[model samples]
Target: MNRATLLTLGVTMLAPLGSAYAADDVKVVEKPIRVLAGIFSAASGANKQRTAIGVGYDFMKTAATNPTVYGVFLDYNSKKVAGVTTSLTGVGISGRFYLESANAAGKPYATLGVGSYTLKAGTSQSKIGGKLGIGYELNNGWLGELSSTMIQKIGGKDPGGVTFGIGYRF
Candidate 1:
């Protein structure tokens, strides 16, 4: 090929490469408060599924390097045991690592938290445990999450359950 033709081809190919994307060009807004509400269910057994609706909130400082979340939540689990009504309530505080993608369209996160709870059977039983979950954070400040919680029982059984929920950041 001639040098003139080669030079023309190189310039055309390099022109597009000059327009590289920079993360600095994208604006990252920090939200002061994040609130979430969702439903939770625990896998007990046949005719024994614990259920609850919960609300959560997060207040923390944001860092460009590592996105973080700090929050607390409570759930009220009510079920029918032996044809009688029973209720279990739990509360916990957690911090999560929020990971944002390069495109900044969506964010993924993992969380770990610890707290105490109470169950009302024949008597009120108090227990302590930790919670874990993985979820997605949308650019629009909406989030979806799946979680597993484990709270030890008092003279009864293990009170661990799975939860799914949707939340928003403000």
Candidate 2:
């Protein structure tokens, strides 16, 4: 037990892993990016179809863990069928789960989304939707939103809709 006392107990256990690489080295803070659009509708109450226009995007955050918002959305859904003059184009990939309460400051917050629609005579559809909405954030960085999306078309028998939207968040 005396090889210089086992080399002084392995240099006192490697001096706490060499003082953890001299500590202080970890600083990363970068969060600034948000974009949104407006106008969307797909509705039916015994064929009372209401479809609108104007849509937008630019929102990317794969996973957020503090008031849930997991995202990847670049969406555009259009419609114009005023009497069979047919017009429909939906190109999308959308997924969102939302909840944000900033201690009730200028209130309104609740969102839930799911989308997969590709229809420009290419017939590919999937949308299981949700939206019970209210949103307000105006401190010059305008974010005024009102949402609703209740879609069900996962195989083709397309007749399910409820989308009312207004958005602007940059």
Candidate 3:
């Protein structure tokens, strides 16, 4: 009889502790502003490599497996690709979906972005383009990603290349 009473008391005491742990598995956020700034290393379709700096912010969040973010950013790429002199100024809307567990180690995410850009290659011309990439979010509030962006109407070429970036989520 005494053993049964102790077992019942122990179970009652541990149940609430287990429940508290479950609640901590998810991040409790009350509206967050996401911001990131990173440098882009790109290889254009013209077989040229260029570098650019980009900054972005996400103003909306949707609940699914985790928090999904959507916002906009600006990018500027140098015009020195494959010995061709040119530059690109771009502005676009971006979206990211976070998949996996969100914790101190953060999670993995995929991104999609669309924008309009002006290419300066002797003459200034405008085009519509987009970017796609995959990245990992670190627990230290930093992000690392590899992306590809494409532009239209530059020497009959598509300027899409891989970009490696490191930034922050705030």
Candidate 4:
């Protein structure tokens, strides 16, 4: 099976877990205002290259005493090709788990999630990945993050690779 198919299958297998969150209260939130742009390197076996620019957004969510955050994000990327170029577009749900720091300042965090990726190779796919980042919270309810991810490709022609971006928490 190809990556997209595997993703769909995996999500299908995990459909029951969605019900667990039903007991939790659902709330709407907005986050701090910030943006980040950076470059990412990707390698499949031995062929590797770096993309010149990668972009991401941070939509801050409600910050409790524990300072958890939730938001939506989108990312775009491109790969060099001889005649035509290949590209990837990803959109998914994102969140952060914070570690309380000394002095009551913004804390460090780690995040992970799955999303869909549209590739130029004729198939749009869904992928699962994990990320780790360091973040700081300013006095004004603003949070900034720098993180990286390695998405697993189940069915695409290319093996999954790494992505880097920034985030914000309100």
For all predicted structures, in order, the TM-scores are: 0.67, 0.24, 0.67, 0.57
1 against 2, candidate with superior TM-score = 1
**What is the overall TM-score of model 3 with all chains considered together?**
0.67
Off by over 4 Å in 4: 1-34, 45-47, 52-63, 101-105, 121-159, 166-170
Candidate 2 structure quality by residue, lDDT tens digits, 1-170: 22344334334433433333355321221222334455555453222334444343423332233233333344444544533322233333332223444333443445443344443323444443333345565434456665554444444444334444444444
- Give per-residue CA lDDT, model 3, range 1-170, as digits (tens): 13344345335433433444465443333334444444454444442555666777665555445655666777776746556776677787776668875443678998877777777776788767777789998766777887777655466755556677777766
User: Model 1, 1-170: lDDT tens per residue?
Assistant: 23344345334433322332232222234654555555556545333455566666664423445555555767666767677766667787666666664247887888766667787765787777666789898777888888887766556566667777777767
lDDT of 1: 0.62
Clashes of each: 0, 0, 1, 7
TM-score pick, better of 3 and 4: 3
lDDT of each: 0.62, 0.40, 0.63, 0.50
Please report the candidate that would top lDDT against the real structure.
Answer: 3
lDDT of 4 by residue, 36-134 (tens): 445444545322443533333444433345544555556666666665555656666556556663237556666544566555544456555443456
- Model 1 lowest lDDT segment of ten: 17-26
What is the descending TM-score order?
3, 1, 4, 2
User: Better model by lDDT, 1 or 4?
Assistant: 1
Query: What's the distance in Å from true for residue 56, model 2?
Result: 17
Give candidate 1's total backbone clashes: 0
